[model samples]
Target chain A: MSMPKGSNIGQFVVIEEGVKLGENVTIGHHTVILKDTVIGDNVTIGCNCVVGVRKSRNQNMRISNSSLDPLVIQANCKIGNHVSIYSGTTIAQDVFIADHASIRENVEVGPGTIIGRGAIIELNTKIGHDCTIQTLAYVTGDTTIEDHVFIGPCVSMSNDKYMGAREYTLKGPYIQEGAKIGNNATLLPGITIGSSAVVGAGSVVTKDVADFKTVVGSPAKDIRYLVSKEVSEHDTTT
Target chain B: MSMPKGSNIGQFVVIEEGVKLGENVTIGHHTVILKDTVIGDNVTIGCNCVVGVRKSRNQNMRISNSSLDPLVIQANCKIGNHVSIYSGTTIAQDVFIADHASIRENVEVGPGTIIGRGAIIELNTKIGHDCTIQTLAYVTGDTTIEDHVFIGPCVSMSNDKYMGAREYTLKGPYIQEGAKIGNNATLLPGITIGSSAVVGAGSVVTKDVADFKTVVGSPAKDIRYLVSKEVSEHDTTT
Candidate 1:
């Protein structure tokens, strides 16, 4: 396969065959882009990143022998250092995936999302547009996050309520539009965060959160609202 | 220097000089082992791992010139993919460090410990034998995790109470023997988790946890008596 036009690659990069890149892409040092990966224009991937790898982790190990599909990175996305994007994933345009983030296989992340540093988006997750998953969050598998959601730093979502006893099928949270999960919150399996709901920091959410409600504490209970505020002091994407 | 006898080195591996490997050590693809690393017998390191590197991250960036010691990995350890172990650390035998686990420099991890997937044990941490640091947990710098302690998933421990304001000296928690920290729990700096105590899931611990007590919620308060269970259900090292 021929190299795409105007793609600048750094030292010790290993790009396998059948990988395609668009123009003005900057691939950083010590990156390994595996086969059947496609990159769009104006993408900048940082150092020590691994794109389209077959994941070997215990929670998200998926190595498909049946005609491996391509991992696609859309235009204007910025991938940070030491990131790992597995195969069978499609990142939409203008996404900013931060450093040490791991996007597992069969995931679909929509446009304008910011996956924060050291966050783990597990297998088969679907994240929609304008979402912000903050630093060190653990988003479990089979999750569906809708548009404009904000998952805070160190938020932990679980797919296994029984802790891998295999009693139930694994399913992560279904976060609706504009829902906000605070830092260090824990969402149990298969729960739904309603539109504009707020799960407070360090909360353990054991049930579904209704629309515009605010929940706090362990087995998070609803509290009366004091004041309405914007999601963050500053917007993530300018 | 010649390759170590019966050691299986993978393709495109970058091993520097004066690194010693024992018999039956299997190093996977795209791994970079730096100088002065000593790997013992029957060690299995997975793909894209960086062992014994001079770390570049903040709070662990110690490229020592005076008395630069080698990183030592003892026998029968299993290191998973994309893991990073910094220099001047010693990992004892039969430890299982899972995928994306980062152990920083000047640290010592004892035998039979399970450093779980995506867990980050920061600089100068000392973890004893039979400890379970579960998935995505963040053990901050200068911590001491004693034997038979079970630190749960996404448990966050901090060293800097001043939020990097440089007011007080930084120190993480000292978790004593047989302590159990539940999922999404946050431990404040310079605190002590006493022996056989249980910090409940999603709790924000502001002070020291007493022995044999169970603490819950923000500024965690204790509940009444519960039977002390062993931290590990089964022994990690047979």
Candidate 2:
């Protein structure tokens, strides 16, 4: 274990062998960093977090996760208490992950994303920069989200349309840049949400949305085309 | 600390002073049991859990939670890893609380309930017997839930109608017996979900639902009355 200059680690923290911590790192009590994890400068992790966590697959899970890469957290990230970040993940700089959030393996979180409390980012997902995934949201595996997207509280995206009843290929939703998914919305598998689209609260998106279109209701239908590029201010606060 | 006969405690477990554990209790690694917590016989708690957690109020909050009762867990309950159950809570016997769940203060979870993984049960809620609150569901504060209710994954209930912008009393939904709220459903504040009512997936419920009625869509409308008492088998699996 190598801790660089100005690092302050709390008691009962377990930094395993081959772990490297950069300058000005602050880790709280009972945090566990697994082997070969790298933390950049000015990172602050709160209590009871388990970084670089090893993966354990259930027997019925069909997804192949046999091989995994080491974890990497870039500079100036703020991780809250009771977070569980797995191995094979790379979190970019200036991200704020709130308390009790769980990020699964093989995930990529871009810079300055705000993952709200108790949000679950599943394996093999790619999240772009400056996004907000709010509380209790479930970003399922194999999803791709572009930059500046805002996902409201309890938004659920499904990667498998079959719901694990039979063998099927998994393909999650592809959300383009600046899209806003409202609270309690559900995105079906393999759909594409176009750029700057606005999905209303509690809408169930079943198909592709065009750029700048506003959709609402279940089997979400187009309400109007957005005249401006800016996402709704109400969306970010939800 | 008093541990009854046949209790098995793992390494790094912190059982604080005045805590009591009954016979055949199993506590996993690095779990923290705060002062004066009572765990009954044959209970099992998994790794990294925090039981009997003290509450901290946010500076801007209007609710008063100055007084709290001690935490109690009855026999034969199974608590999963990374769970957080706060002070003033009572979890009844045969309840199964899955991993990453957070139960707040002043809550009551009745017998044979199943709280799914990553579920958040907020403060002052009363959950009755044989209930199932599924994965990623958000049960907001000040709610009253009756027996044999089923809340699906990512279901969100609101307690404040104004979203905290104004001064208002917080009152969550009152869900009666045998109600089934489908996946990603959103229940607005202070509404009564009547007995055995079925709320469909992705619905945004804004009003009172009558007993055994089925409602769907945004600003949810009544579809039909359920003919039977049995909740759909599909609802339990979602």
Candidate 3:
């Protein structure tokens, strides 16, 4: 078979056939790009990042069949080292995926979003444009996050209340536009954070948060409105 | 400034001065090794794994400082692609870190251990030798896992009972040698798992588990002695 063409692929870099790559797409050494993967122009994929497809195995049990769809990465995207964009993931244009982030199967990330380092975006999640998902946050399946939202470090969002062994359905949660979720907060499934809402750090959110409201404590109760002072201070520091 | 000698960095890889790399080391493309990190000999660092670290910002708030000390990776280790071994982490010899695993600061992984793919070992935890930490598990801080332990996928271990914003003194919870923890199990702080103990899948363990016993369900109760038949069957399938 003829050698696949790229700018530079270091030793042990595996790229399957039918994978389309745009100009100036630099893939680091030992990176694996599976079949049918499409990468856009000026994209920099860091070393050791696994793109495209994989099978799901559970302790000797083949829990799910192997994935088939190609990963589609848009133009001008900067993917950091060690980022695993799993099968059936579609990353939109101008997205910045930081180091060590895990984007699981069938997840769609909108354009201009920044997936922070070590962030975990679970399967079947839809993240909107211009969102900033911070480091080490966990976004579970069937969740929808709107545009310009900010999720803090170690934020945990759940999909199941009474988690079980077999497959069960829990209603998907929604995080509206411009919302800010604090560090180490847990949001139960089927909840909604309205536009511009703020969930405080370490809070356990059980119910819906109203638009522009600020919630705090366990089973999060609305404390007050989000002050402009806090927002301004946050902007200056960043 | 002159680059540090013996730094086996690949093409398109950048390493700031003062970063030390041992013999026969391979660094993948577009991977950056920041200052003050030390990597040992015969270490296979996979593509896109970020060594050393950076701080994270949320909504302009300097949430938690995720800064770690210079990372030290020991000899004969196999680190998978896209794994993030953060600062202040010391990985002992003969360790296997799978793809997409995130090991945060101040964690010490003993020799001959296997950290599965997508597992997150949080700060200040001590994992013993010859242990198997499964995929997608979240292990919080100050926990002690003894040698020959087996931790299954999606297991959650916390440091606090009433988890809140305040900083509480975290004592080490003990997992004795040869213990086996099942998938999606939750372990509360200050609890102990005795030697050769077994925790079933999807259980919320609120108390201590006795040695050589098998525990299941919420507030994990001892069901019976762990049979060799079950263990052998489980081993073959995984």
Candidate 4:
């Protein structure tokens, strides 16, 4: 129930006790900031957002009642409307999370990331700096994304091989640095997208994509090398 | 505000003036119904929903201050939690819109249409009766979906050719009757899916699909005819 100095909160908003907010924060209407949450300076949260909420739906979630580290949002972040950000997550500075996006518990998102509208980042995922997760994309649980990665709209990355039965060791995709995944692409579980690789739109990547390669179509065959000097020169000329 | 007989309104529900509600409607907590909205009998609207909202952000939208038709929802439709339905939309009877689904303005959804969880139907789309739009699917604007069409999970339909550059008469894919689009498939703009056509999982449909054809892969080639007599005979024999 403690409000930091110079912070502006909108109507019908609820900020519980032990929630630490920094200066110059603007919280929009109908937002709920739960207990043990922490926000840094110059943050803007839009309307109808639920921050630090517990994952009540997942039966297998590693939910702890013991005192733990609060959900943290670093400086200069913009959170859009109708977003649900769960507990035990840390978001770095200069992050833009757009409307209707959901980020589950135990996730760490690095600085300068843009999570687009309606995107869902599931539990236990770690996304590095300068990444772009486009609109309506799904980054499944336990995924690891390196810096400068771009995931286009409607991209879906799965984690579980055997869906919803007895759970095996559910490991998601590992996307390396400078990788680009185009629109409507599906990455199967435990696969690796190598550095600087380009996955074309609507590709179903079943196996590991090699570095500097472009993959397309179902089961995603390697089409061409992505990082030729001629290609860079051609781009500069264009 | 006129309360119809035998309707149950939950806590924090906001229904504006000139909104007409039918009998036995159950509106959950924190749901907002704007002005000029008309609701039919036995409709169950879940929590945290925003209905009949105008698209305030689109500067190119056809916004009018004059009198217009109210947003309409017919009887016995179940709207799930956290949904946003815009104005100038009509949802027919027995339609089930699942959680986190967003239906935009000027859309007409026919009876018995199942819009699955997290599906987004863009503006001015018309979906016919008994159509199934599965979870996390995106139905782009200016689309026509016929009866008994099944769009599987994570399917994406795009309406742009130039993609936010100069728009070329943006029209989405037209899905004919009994067409089935499998999981994670993508449909490019201005394409027609003929009757009883089946698009395989992870397919990228760039052209028109013929009637009764089963297409697969990127640029979706026809792999087989769906309605063979031998298949029907085998099914009956089994």
In candidate 4, the residue pairs with backbone N, CA or C atoms under 3 Å apart (3 or more residues apart, or in different chains) clash, namely none
Rank by lDDT, descending? 2, 4, 1, 3
TM-score for each predicted model, relative to the true structure: 0.75, 0.68, 0.56, 0.72
**Per-model tally of clashing residue pairs:** 0, 0, 12, 0
Models ranked on DockQ: 1, 2, 4, 3
DockQ of 3: 0.09
Q: What share of the reference contacts is kept in model 4?
A: 0.19
| Candidate 2 residue A24 C-alpha distance from true site, Å | 7.1
lDDT string for model 1 (B206-233, tens) is: 9898898888766687754222222232
Better of 2 and 3 by DockQ: 2
Separate DockQ for every predicted complex:
0.24, 0.19, 0.09, 0.17
Selected candidate, larger TM-score, 1 vs 3: 1
* lDDT of the candidates, in the order given: 0.83, 0.85, 0.76, 0.85
Tens-digit lDDT string for candidate 1 (A1-238): 5657887898878787888899999999878887789999999999878788754432223343421567899999999998888788999999999998888778999999999998988778899999999998888778999999999998987665544323577688899999999998888778999999999987889789899999987768886532222333235444
Candidates 1 and 4 compared: the better one by DockQ is 1
TM-score of 4: 0.72
Clashing pairs in 2: none
